[model samples]
Target: MASSSSSSSSLNFTVRRCEPELVPPAIPTPHEVKLLSDIDDQDGLRFHVPMVQIYRKKESMAEKDPVQVIRQALSQTLVFYYPFAGRLREGPHRKLMVDCTGEGVMFIEADADVTLDQFGDSLQPPFPCYQELQYEVPGSQEITNTPLLLVQVTRLKCGGFFLAIRLNHTMCDGPGYQQFLSAWAEMARGATKPSIAPVWRRELLMARDPPRITCNHREYEQVPDTVKGTVTPNQDDMVQRSFFFGPLDIAALRRLIPQHLRHCTTFDLITACLWRCRTKALQIEADEDVRMMCVVNARGQFNSPLPVGYYGNGFAYPAAVTTAGKLCGKPFGYAVELINKVKGEMTEEYLQSVADLMVMKGRCLFTTVRSCIVSHLARFNIREVDFGWGEGVYAGVAQAGGGSFPGISFFCSAKNGKGEEGIVFPICLPAAAMERFSQEFNHMLRNKNQPQTTSATLIMSNL
Candidate 1:
């Protein structure tokens, strides 16, 4: 999450941008409104999520201008993914719908004085001047009646470019957005249509007739909005930093687990480790429940698997909770088990319950009390996209958590400075916790002899 040279030096650049304009589909789309599923209209996804993809220059394509190619590709791509060109509108009962108006999405062309190499070895999250890279049109940040997609392509000094896109989270989840993006890339490569067709079966994920709440959805449960200690930091005090877990780092984590539980995924292992380290760094009181939420792609969870190109929100946030004391005091397996349980319990019925709860609660936001949410974009095929220039060097979320709140991190599949394949996840904490987290996290990877710290043990005695 830490920006390389983002804060340190006198690194400076001026971005010259053209006036933003609306880009519509090359072919006309039907003019009608499409109702969004309960999951899509949830409170948590009511804003635009920004992403940045850095593409290095390709000698073979030196003559072509990426800006023109991408801009044209986006126009052609929108013909099939037309909903992205529409504006979202809210209906009665807080439901959301897209007015399939061909008004188009916001697009801008720009050139930056800095080259890709000037950004240094890492181009991960917490990118410097991210807002400039993915500029928001005056009222485009508003939830309704605005462009569902905001795109800005800034050519770098070395001929490489940064393709920045901000899509309404309500329109699509990780997979959905990736599908749309890959199609755009295909179009840029002169493909008349996407290799895989896009589908708008939002109705498939809609709440069952006479919605019923079956599962106990703790992720969204409203609780006392309290923080007893200085564990949770103010938005201003938070700092972003990323940690890369290569194959060796993962092997080290697995060493702590029993052979049976070692079958758990790299995500489970790392999330558990992070939750424990963060909880220890926070020093949250024992007996106080600390929560961790994982964004599970529920496409296959349905009895009938979701269509491949059905680009809608197909993920669910299932939460795992345990007291901070137990989390930090117990062995690493304790945290891993909690995560495993949350993953195992999610089913089609569970997703339906989430839908029911959304309507019943009038679209309440996910619970934030003593909690942090983690979303993984590693398998979204970000690095596979090619706009003729070729696959990007770095492609993922533009930044860590939103400015309003902290503790939200993203997992991206990337190589380290040493070019080792692994997962790179970024975390934002108050300066003090950040230092402690870095020290402990590095200590874990470097020295296996050091015992896991046992703190807040007294609180473990309580229920």
Candidate 2:
């Protein structure tokens, strides 16, 4: 039945035998490591919300041999399963292994008429299709009884189709995901095999036994009062949407920030600008405390170290700071300064603080940290998620649009420098606030001294 969808052309693909890579040889980190049994404590600390969108021109040949294209595509895309290495003890249950079920990829169907505009329309402004998948997960979890890949098909008025790929972020970062896709595309194009094989053994990242928490870990964990929250923003309080910021504009803004502030790199500059924009958009009070959260990959942060191919969640949260009033009034350059100062806090002491708190306080720490925070920016490598269709225009998470205090956001880039140059940021804020925020954001991009295009806009809605 699946084959019937494809044309009779030479194009053909299939999900043959694919297995997870062998665990790499590496020392294990003992003291700081959490066994599968201890994972409950890290529950919400990590979320698996990775997804991709593929755009392809419609062709008569494709329709004639739907399966051919799909199969070819599937063949090109590589898939694998990473099993939980450590044993989990729960009462009588001796050893329970955790694997990302064979379901790690999904396909969404859409026709040509569903331009990015319409897709955005369907999502409804701030709320975008990308963000709606969270609701789809629980239902999927019920259907598959585990984290599974999801695919959707939609017929558009035009001939082309849009494919949305959803995967559990826990499995891989954007780059890793792209590598798998590129391999699949090659296969779909009739390649005998993928260009590069995937690496999955967690042993590669295992730290020396008796893992020692490095001091740098402490700096990234510290945060502020007003920025922290007791409860994370719920669905009612937040919506989701995707926004594009052209690279040229970002580059222009980058030139504007003082030299002292630019040293921290891309994340610092973009985030600092955003902090200023969000503050201006919301017209936040100068005295009110505001914070911006950034994801820190913990793979190499610890003193002991982690195993290579450690495919589990290895991320930490650090933040930039500002008062509502200060952020709103400052020039973009000043915001960069704030961003630099706060990021400096991510030091060994901070890591230790977080480790001690986690070990001493246990699960409660996760909650304390999650609540006392507002907005999260995970700069995971997005450009790497390439399926056979070449590189992606952009890849990343959509924000939960309309929200109360402490908004959460995500940033990623396109496969190539094709679509937008800078990061694809999904922001969620109130309508009134975003309008104002958009203005300042544009102004920063179009500074006469360093002018840039205003390609990104906030289409507020309840997708």
Candidate 3:
């Protein structure tokens, strides 16, 4: 094992690359092929998703070295997910493709000198400490040189361990990647085969012709092109916070909406509250059109749903746009209506139309300064991943860097050491706006006469 020390007093770790093992047998012909769908082409070329999960000490895990178990399972799992061991190459048409050269995924082993409790309750630590746990692939900007996935395992002094993962978004979406992780965990637990085998039929998402524009696509047109140049606040001027909402809080939000809309799902209600609070926090011009960009899974929206194991970008980007003043001034039900309207509009024809539009434009939709992107992961089996040690105490997405666009939040399930059920929001905002956002968010929870919000606050304060 390799070790390095950190300057921070909180946590320190040393990292070293583990020996690489190729998955498939070497052959004269390499598995080189283009991606199934061009939808991924619109994604930022160099952007990757980073996640960290902490597993507390367990007797079963302590008896067997977690590193060895993870290594053995990962190597075996890659046999099926071989494309992860390959490099990204440009096809003849300048599109990206996976060149299955069997270079192998990057694996790093680290020794953390701190205990799990000492690392704190929030899974996300400061960037310095968090970055060390994740493996950074060299030459990440160069497609051909970058590995599709990187894994880091850090063993803590308390017997607990942290698994940091970095995966190229171009290769797969959240659900697809989660499936891979779940399968790997199953292997680590000694399963001979994964319960769900991944299917790589990307061509199934290809666009159709006549370029149908079946409903209004004003959402895409509403996104400003100048968003790429929008300024990001300095790290010192930014604050990241996590807020939890229990069943009571959710019910209260539903009550705020009209009876007609009360039937909306819990996700719709919570997202509406977030949109309203965030809009108020920013205090943008009343006339300014603020939008909430949401990612909708398109797998089941098709007339004939995609396979359960379909590992591709089976998602759509839909936005709910309204003036900041309208959002802040209207009753909570208004925001819910806007969101539900967009959700309801996502029919089979609508999704197909969006695909056709993207194919025609040869680009992906972009968000603007007025846009706040939100992702819901509460339904994903994030807390269910077990590597023989036990279920993770905390598992969620980690920020890529210190700075990010003003408003980005991920809603996931929360396990606060207690047997309570709640939803947690990992949010990033400008420091100047966090205080107000927190106040507004808490106000809604407390006004619901919910006691769980108090517990949620205590949990966050400990972090």
Local distance difference test, candidate 3: 0.69
Q: After superposition, which runs of candidate 3 have C-alpha atoms over 4 Å from their true positions?
A: 1-4, 7-30, 44-46, 92-94, 124-128, 141-144, 210-213, 222-236, 400-406, 417-419, 448-453, 458-463
Task: Give the lowest summed-lDDT range of ten residues in model 2.
Answer: 1-10
Model 3 lowest lDDT segment of ten? 454-463
CA RMSD, predictions in order: 5.8, 8.9, 3.7
Cα lDDT tens digits, model 2, 304-325, are 6545434444444665555666
- lDDT-sorted candidate list, best first: 1, 3, 2
Q: Rank order by TM-score, top first? A: 1, 3, 2
The C-alpha lDDT values of all candidates are 0.80, 0.44, 0.69
lDDT of 2 at 316: 48
Question: Which residue pairs clash in candidate 3?
Answer: 3-14, 4-14, 36-202
Query: Which ten-residue region of model 1 has the weakest summed lDDT?
Result: 454-463
The TM-score measured for candidate 3 stands at 0.87
Error of 1 at 434 (Å): 1.4
For candidate 2, give the lDDT of residue 20.
Answer: 19
